[model samples]
Target: MLIMATKLNKKLLKTLSAVLFSAVVFVGCNDFFGDKTDLSFIDLPEFTNRDIAYVPIQPAWDQFVYPTDICIGFDELLYVVDEATQQIIGLDESGREQGRFSVPGVTSVTQDRRFDLLACGTLDTVSASGDPITLACIYRIRLLNQNGQYGIRYARIVNKIIHPFYSRSNVNAQDLTVRFGKVAIMASDIPSQNNRYYVTRQGQGGSSILGPNDAVLIFSNTDQFETPISVSTSSGIFNNFFQKPSGIATYAVPPQIQASQERHFFYSSVDPANELKVQFIEYIETDFGAEFRPVIFPVGDTSRADGFLFEPNKFSKPSAIAVAGDNTRFLFVVDEEKDSLFQFTRDGFEGVLPPPATGRTKLEKASFGGTGNGLTQFNRPSGVGYYRRIVYVADSGNGRILRFRLTLDFN
Candidate 1:
């Protein structure tokens, strides 16, 4: 045991060094989030594509030209929004066309807790003083029942702020989500300059160019715009301001845990960017007013102050996101560019941030579908909704709606 050790050969030394380096790299890549467990090796349940329903598009009559969004009503019926046709078509559980309502220049649709369908779009109308103005507004439609007939009535309109100087409203409503009797509308070109809204004049006259502050405008259940929550990228906290806030999904906290939580609402956003990232924000109520606090969830080896997940190469133009109702255990995101749906689970991460990784929250589980027109594929899928363990996808490019069910493994 006291004998002098033999000098190692140069080749052997190099081999040992290479082996150590490889081991370090492997550990660094796999356990970047300071977790001992490897997420790639975690066994999770897979999502199976059960059925696909195509909306009839023909020469005589076209039901859906470019379906952009979808919502699940209180009655469990599916409402699909078509941008090209400017209509929200209702489909039964079996994917049959039940009824359709026209909403001109429609961009997004959602059903409130009262079973009233809320449609967000642009409309041409006169201002309060009778001036011609184009405005972005939300229309609430009530479901009527008479003689076994599915009659729909246009109830009221919640008009967004329109600048008196400009002919059209500066706000460009992208998406809307209703939760806890509150409506959150994602918009761009928010009035910020000296509390005034301005837009750059294109073409021959283009000098008055004023930038806008993108925001999430809050509205009450009575269809009134309350205040605008501006999302700023200037602070070192946020990675960037939302360029194109496409879709939003809200999660309501359960009653049992509501007392202990300062943040009641958990919302996710899908912004179209070069590197698609999913932004998570918690709706916190402060003494001043309601605030949207960005949650910095750990993803891979880094911690993002603005987003929970970041995979630019994998996500190509993510359009929409949906979380399990009341249960934040599962989440789904629709990638329009890749034409696929990504599933995430709250297995390894914490539910809340700041005190990060204290409790199990959610992480990416698996992904399914691809770019195609087949039954098991998607073409530029836009909106996604989860209800009663079933996921409904608005396959915009293919003019259809695809549904899938979650297959959980107790073992």
Candidate 2:
């Protein structure tokens, strides 16, 4: 009877030891339901359609005066042109200021595949009467120093294409009144035309159509004059196609090797008289060399397309435009008059198509804005930029830069 009692005691002791070991293991590991695991995006179906539109990315960059334009360069850096400061400020993806370069009257900027900045600004020259005159100019800024360092502070204006002087040696009365708008750095598979860029010029033209005023003019990679764009429409080759064109964009966006080599671009016009304000032009090779042709869209044909980019009287003042370089190829336009940021699919639809199998048929109207300083609102927003799934807007009247990401892009 004593031995049996001792054996029971030993068994009880062993069981107690095992329980303590288990408790220690649990404590050393995670408590309760183990390490907290975030629910996957799909695990929450309640988010469906509720957060399907663009959501703000908090804490806007609010340090500028009349920020005219913003762009994501080939270097994957953010560049902003501030006309009030007459400077181009460069920043990292985190919005940290990297460097700033001063120009006379910098308004808009675009970077090429070669990483050179092509911007529209003003250059001052002495007239024959010994008076200083500022003419609209295109500047090719090499973001490199003599020591081979890369930075906007080290950037130098290697070349300047002054108005009238770039097109012809002589200047007309209307040339002095001309002002440059935006620059679209073009890309081509051909080596000779790879870095050529297009500049939007505007002027009174002396109330006549004698010159290339209010036109999109092309320049060679070497900064030589190419030709003004003559868009081919259903009405044949139209020389006077652009009216008050202020914004231009190309598909040759950053990360260099991944950029498209297509000679196509999207441009925006602020002209109040035009029915359509935004248009896309493609460089197609024809039997007679090459010509720029406008890509037409079917309007009011819901069965064929939900929306059309060529819809008449759609925009009041589409001041700035951006073409997504990713697989999405989305287009972004910001209207100053309407104070709105509009998004579109590659097919010119008004919004992003609903995700597969959500019991939704129509596209979400992703465009939004008003005349306030809200997260989704803008005050005379003049610039739009896109990279990856993020969109950046230059709220010039508000003196800030706003960023947003579509909720559909959430992981």
Candidate 3:
């Protein structure tokens, strides 16, 4: 039983070394990300073995010049708004064009349960000198069925929603989201600074860039958008600084084993320093009104923070976050830069939840089929929303909306 004696044979020794090396490599290759991967040494599990799956959706219609935002109608039709074309295109589930509409001055679109849509844009007016600048405007689009297809017939100006003050109100609405009968609007001005009440206060020695920290305006219970309640994310916790809130969704499910309703709001903050941060603000009702406290989640590793970009870059900056219906623990984020999707479990956050298994982890975290060549496959993936078990992605860059089914059983 003297096994060491076998080392005397050169051929056997070489085979033994090869077997050991293969075992080591196999042990190191257990990854759970996606079709694309990033880390050099990290080899992902082959897609076939893993329970995860993806179906590429092709556009049924022509591509928009530069699609930016998207939303799904209650009827299950997908609507896309293109910034370059200044037009709204509709597509069926199969990716074919169902209908289309045009606007004079519109930039983005968001839809609600009422089958009403919110169109955001900057109203441009010429000065006496003939130079053009933008003023903020939001239009509520009412859709009607014309010959078995959806059509946009009437648009109304949503003046005076949540923020009632409106002194020199030049906030250009960027994103619109509606939940629990409340429509949320986000906007900023010239310096891209946000303030509670933006006031220049004539001759008070104001800074050229001074304004209320960025604002989140909430419009509630009115198709007219007349009665608005404004909520500000600025507080001492923000410590007299500024944070920009983008892509908001409301979480209003009943607290488990509790009597009261839980109203939680989730948003992405693209602060230059903390561009990878996602903030969760909870609203607890008090005698006066709603109270705001922000819980911040720093994305990726803080060590490589410099790579984080507020503006679109090669690596994705978490642009939008949405909660899947069945499990609040399942959260999805769309990276506008990489034009990909990332899924994280509740435990994935360093909070009360336990860490999710490798199978239930981040996807699209790296280069697939090698380097820059693979990105051309994606256009500009934007906003994500859900209806029942189905997930909808606004394939903005591709000029179509892709539908997918959410599943688990990662091998």
Candidate 4:
């Protein structure tokens, strides 16, 4: 009996030891195990016809063959810049094309009529080797209606308006925004001609020094506007830095948190060789100004080369992005290559809500892909804007304007 009791105690001790060992191993391997499975996207039902809003273009402004970027103004008007013709057109609320005006050496337009301001970036110079020159200054314009033909009455030249402070090229300020006496610009440029290493890195997939912007540049204080904060980098990853900075919007939550955390800014990027990486960066208002780095999403997280798993075979080249209202976890993106528009949402922190049920929304059948839309397929679709119930796209290649009004809600 004594020997049997001793044996039982020994068995219990061994079992307890094994359990403790297993617990330790489990704790240590949790992150590894989680990473083992593909967590970039969630396994959800393919999108059906649930969330979609498609509207046709009114025939007037449809004259553009290649449209570059779009802006919304005060009188329920839509303005589109045609880089090809150096012209800008206006569209009325009913989708009817009103008339057109011209801009000298102007390639883009960015403005919100509600704020009574507009801005654009110009390719000031170019090298004989055909490389684009620096974006010297951001031209500001004020929209006015002169007997129905829209006119740019107010203008100013702001020099060296580069945001995130790392972009080598300049912005097409037409991709920027002005609201509540604040000018929020998404300035992008490939690394400038600093050294041969910068050029080679951009060409050979090497590290880009000033390509990725360190922060969204802000020019505030006109009416008590504050200077912008800067973005930082812990990882050295950089290149094609600001290849495409489509849209800029501010997130203001007031009467809530401390004044410092009241506002945030979100911007988007579409990097192809970088694994078709579509990234959203958030800028927090710190003691100085805007602070930013890439925000990690559980889903849609992968190296720049994994390619978009959803459309692996199709060539995915995204261009523009816009956030949804009510501060939802969704964004509208345009793929210039496909000439199709996609709606993506954050499914928790781990998955991207797939494209809407209507599948891919077509802006115009003939000029839907490539750069711009017009009587032709989009030549080089570039910028996008969302407000109230409507969505706007910059049909850069076609020099035309396209608009879509959201008719359905996505739960």
Best of the candidates, lDDT: 2
Worst 10 residues of 2 by lDDT: 39-48
Against the unseen true structure, what C-alpha lDDT does each candidate score? 0.51, 0.82, 0.45, 0.43
TM-score of every candidate relative to the true structure? 0.59, 0.85, 0.57, 0.52
Instruction: Give the candidate order by descending lDDT.
Output: 2, 1, 3, 4
Judged by lDDT against the true structure, how good is candidate 3? 0.45
Residues 234-350 of candidate 2 have per-residue lDDT tens digits of: 889877899988898888876446567788889998999989899888889978798899888657767544566888988999989998878888899999999999888777788
Candidate 4 Cα errors over 4 Å, as ranges: 1-60, 96-101, 112-116, 123-135, 144-216, 221-247, 251-263, 285-290, 300-315, 326-330, 346-379, 396-399, 407-411
In terms of TM-score, the best-performing candidate is 2
Candidate 3's error at 137, in angstroms? Answer: 1.8
How high a TM-score does candidate 4 get? 0.52
Quote the lDDT for 227 in model 4: 32
Candidate 1 stretches with Cα past 4 Å from truth are 1-63, 125-134, 145-213, 231-240, 252-276, 286-290, 301-308, 311-314, 326-328, 346-364, 409-411
lDDT of 3 by residue, 1-411 (tens): 112322334456577678667756655554743243333564322222223333332322346666666665545666777767777777665666666676545555665544556665545555445666444455566675435544543333444232212333332332111111112322223222111111101011112333333444444334222212233465433322324444655432111121112445565544455544555566567787665566544455533232222223323455566655445455556666666655554323321121254332334222111112122234556566655555566556666555554323211
Q: Better model by lDDT, 2 or 4?
A: 2
Which candidate do you rate higher for TM-score, 2 or 4? 2
